[model samples]
Target: MAFVRVAALSQLPEGGALGVEAAGRRIAVARVDGEVYAFADNCSHRDFPLSHGEVDAAARTITCEWHGAAFCLLTGEPTCAPAFRPIAIYPAKVEDGAVWVEIADEPAPAEKAGGLRSLGI
Candidate 1:
């Protein structure tokens, strides 16, 4: 996977999360305590956009708004139910005042075998 520019670092406020499209993928980027994290934007429980959810800096998690599914900000592992499956996590960082995310050249992890499935998009 190669890192690609997604957004300006300034665009992500402290304790904030942003949804971006990069490398033909919908990624959710979050800023927690000055560190950046990225994951697939879709919720593992409802196929809803996780970007519409809330960011918990203290817990280092992002919660899905529809069914209260929460995922680890760094690992994309589901931390709460209605979402037992984990979403895909991407490496992210701030470089030269810009946010960069690495999208795997192969299919996203969430699409592979053992991947979680929500109701539908």
Candidate 2:
């Protein structure tokens, strides 16, 4: 895994999320009560960008603005209908006041190993 710098910690406010692209992948980085979580930017329901969604700090969930789908921020699990599949999640770390994301050199299979096959990649 290679750690790619995404943004400065100060740039992201608590209870907010930032969308970043690294290695051709979109990542949603959120800060909740001083902790950071990272997930694939697209919502599993409609392929909408999760960064455009709302972040619920207390519930630790991200609600898609497009289709009302809600997903757990910490685990990226879909908690509502219309989105039975969970989004992909990545490991993140903060060091020296900067956010770094661990991106695999080779893209890993999607959250469900064979699930993306239908996409005809």
Q: Which model scores highest in TM-score?
A: 1
TM-scores, one per candidate: 0.92, 0.87
- Model 1 CA lDDT for position 43: 85
Residue-wise C-alpha lDDT for candidate 2, range 8-119, written one tens digit per residue: 9998888888999988888889988888888888887767788888999999999989879899986777899777777877888899999898888765455455322223
Error of 2 at 39 (Å): 0.4
For model 2 the local lDDT of residue 94 reads 90
Where in model 1 is the C-alpha error above 4 Å?
114-116, 119-121
Compared with the true structure, all predictions reach lDDT values of 0.85, 0.81
lDDT score at residue 59, model 2, on the 0-100 scale: 97
Worst 10 residues of 1 by lDDT: 112-121
Q: Give the poorly placed runs of model 2, Cα more than 4 Å off.
A: 108-121
Error of 2 at 73 (Å): 1.6
Candidate that would win on lDDT: 1
Q: What is the C-alpha RMSD of each candidate to the true structure, in Å?
A: 1.9, 3.1
